[model samples]
Target: MSEREMETTDDDRGMDQLHVAGVTLTGVARGGVETCLMAKELGVMFDIGMCPPGAQRYGTVLASHAHADHLGGVHYLASLRSMFGQKPLKLHVPVEAAEPLQRIFAAWSELEGYQVPVEIFGHAPGATVTIRRDVQATCFRTVHRVPSLAWVVERVSRRLKPEFQGREGAELKRLRQAGVEITDEHRAPELCVTGDTQIEFLLSDESAMARRARVLVHEVTSWEAGDAGAIARTRRWGHTHIDELIAAAERFEGEALVLVHRSMRHSRKAAEAVVARMPPSLREKVHLLGN
Candidate 1:
């Protein structure tokens, strides 16, 4: 763990680096610097804080909000994808950021003397965006200084109807012939990525998707025992403090809980010490993504 921590570079470029429950999570997230996560298998990225050229391989990017620390590299990413002759990048963003982002792209096109191939889709809270045939991203509002969203990636599956569980194949065929629906669609939360939000977002019922996700990647920006005033600063800035995270450990039922976007003020050693102090079970389930 120590060696790996030391190896984390400014951009956190890697392939299939951190596998959690069949999904690969990799990114660079130091508070106020950058925050991005690429789920390689799903071909979906959560943010583009500092989009590395390699990220072009992912066909879609879901921007949580317009915060520069999270979506700063979007234009550069689009330009790179276009330059490499990759297919147009599909960007899913909050509805509020659509116009400004489009204007920025247009300006870039004018400045660079070429149009960047990019498709932008603005989604409102509680809206669902399809990522693929079996998978989709459900956007939910989160507490942030800007209009932000947390994405829950769910996979659609099918299960036999309760009444048809014991039916023989011939009987099932007969039922199908009669136009009976023998199977029910099931949606399971596979991964939840919270770009940057206050602790209340995770503690409230609104975050049910994150609580039930197989893997949760969340932001825990400030984790220091400075003073009462400093703790308030965390909340005021739309971030989560360390104490809040420790107190809310029991609320997370996910198989893995990844903590990212730690404050640059805290030393790596100090942050690890704080995580080491978590309850044994929670500690085992938690993985800190730090720089």
Candidate 2:
């Protein structure tokens, strides 16, 4: 297809080839442009900047805030699912943006002449919802111009209680047969995706989810070196500068960091060049998601 025709197509917009944290992660993100990510394994997507006609495959989507770049495709996704007769889609949005989003959906539903099968949920920081069996999601505050939120997906499982660790199989069976509480709940931070936030969100103790996550997806809109003034603009826009991440490298404990939401002004080469200069300790764990 021609370039213009390609852009108008219902394709995933080049999001199909991505893989992250053992899941199919697809989508795009650039400052003031589209931004979205889908974790196929969890059947959940983060944001809805650009929706493919087939987004009904994503059973649940979490919107960080109401920014156009973050929620531009929400209506399309919901309408497509309803039109195609797919299972109901769940949209979890920040409490502040919930009403506005519902109104938008209501308008579309009226125009389409059919009730959209989308359920809107409002969540504030500290609210936890079970996404699936053994998987749960929690939101945390993110410092952005709008009321944004960062999400953490945790894996919850049951492990033998410390007191029962050394128990014999027969004893364990007996305890279980006796209805004893031989297992303890264990939760591990599996993934964290922050849409648009200042560096403070990553550096603060409140971001415990990011610190403990096995994989973290964060925004690094600008990495121009020696541009102190430019760095200031990043903070002013509620985005993080790469230098801040470098400065607080030791504080991050995630196994891998997926750096995304790059500014369109920076070419892929420019972004890679900056990554190349990162400290070896930090470089090895960074995955630059070029726009």
Candidate 3:
């Protein structure tokens, strides 16, 4: 079945929902307009575009950059959570953007006559943070006009050590009682959300997790592959073109390659047509997210 056939919409909230690779992604992504996505199963939200409905539920938000379309909703989310008696929101953003965002939140607090409750952490490329006991997030640098990051969430599990693989249950229990470490921790990349970045991000050496993630949410702002000038213009603005993404698609070993942050100039129908014309190998894994 096609990705579109498995997709569903939430018109009341003005969000598009997609269930792929065993996770549900909910939110909107329109270039220069708004771009927020929630991976509820991971208890995290990527970006906070205008703080759409149901965003308050996620205790943690991983922001890719400071663009208005991606990070504009930071204050709104914090305030909403406070109003509803929820814990202070935990927001993780690029190190370069952290202080500036804090200043912005201070300004908002002064204007509102109340402090906005939030804990913002600045993370540089290669930084990792624990989202939950089994889930963690790691950020990597992306090529963009401003400092930006692509977040990868990994699920960690423990498996029996190779040496103990064939051991009987009683022997394993005895080893455990004797304080022997019988398992090794393994981390698997589950989802990767690249906020807004040039195509160079995918080609970079630091993009291993983005390529290996089970689900990759990438931006393709320019859908017109036929226009070389248009593709050039998109790169100048630090965004990806469909042609660039298609060229690099095979490098991604993920189950779902979700294309998002499409420019308003192209309609959904037009974008779907572009996907249809792609090589079958790339087409099957590519899915569009947004109305």
Candidate 4:
């Protein structure tokens, strides 16, 4: 989060690091999970309908896919921003999704009388972009029913190397002119939002966004069915059972993992029982929500 990127409504209580992950279970007019990572450099809202009462805390909204739960809060933000005399917000999305999302925005704009800017960008998988360089964003495709994307955002840095810490001669001049190949690793992000995905795309090495990152926001729409047939059916929609979701988490290392979009059938106890059985390492990072 940068000072220039965000216009603080709370001058008395402004926060620099804006990171929050939430999933709306009900009462938001849509059924889905909405995950957002907020900061001054960039404020992105994943999914739509899952807005909590004060979701406008996120300045800009980014839609990971077109599902209502994921996208439900867009109209609310548009209306509020207009009332407050804010500029149109940019919503980054996949190229293929631009059309349908535009239609949704148009409908909302006409009804609300506020024209919000919808900036749909064609994401290059495994490539990088300067969404305010301090917060670089990369998008990778996920195995959802539709063409969904998962994003990884991390702070970027460049520092003078120990070997050339204070070189002020020709060497420093040359390095600056030639753009030294400084390997400033994009610091591992605090959040990784996987829209709605099946393990098929997640397990791919090409999908680096899925393989490594911190704080995974994945969809666990279904829990273990007492019957194998039901679990098999859940697999068809790219949904993972609690156990299988943990198994997938074990494949990558991260600080925390939040799972949302549990089926209406499963009780919270059922979701917890499944987590109670997970291996110790995976269990520590896993959080089951909206079960």
Residue-wise C-alpha lDDT for candidate 3, range 134-184, written one tens digit per residue:
999999999999999999999998999999999899999999999999999
- 2 against 3, candidate with superior TM-score: 3
lDDT of 4 by residue, 198-226 (tens): 76665788665555666676777777645
Model 2, C-alpha of 37: deviation from truth (Å) = 0.6
Winner on TM-score between 1 and 4 is 1
**Position 184, candidate 4: lDDT:** 47
User: In terms of lDDT, which candidate is strongest?
Assistant: 3
Worst 10 residues of 1 by lDDT: 1-10
Local distance difference test scores for all models: 0.83, 0.81, 0.90, 0.60
lDDT-superior candidate, 1 or 3? 3
Candidate 2 residue-wise lDDT, 1-291, digit = tens: 124323332545546445656745666777778788877666578998877543546768877888998888888887776665566778898999989877887888799887777898999898887888888999999999999999999888999988889879999999899999899889998888988998888888899777888888888888787688998999999898888777876677877888888888888788889889988998888887645
- Candidate 3 at 75: error in angstroms? 0.4
Cα deviation at 153, candidate 2, in Å, is 0.4
Candidates' TM-scores? 0.90, 0.90, 0.94, 0.76
Q: Indicate the worst ten consecutive residues by lDDT in candidate 3.
A: 1-10
Compared with the true structure, the alpha-carbon lDDT of candidate 4 equals 0.60
Each candidate structure's count of clashing pairs: 0, 0, 0, 10
Worst 10 residues of 2 by lDDT: 1-10
Q: Which regions of candidate 3 are displaced past 4 Å?
A: 1-14
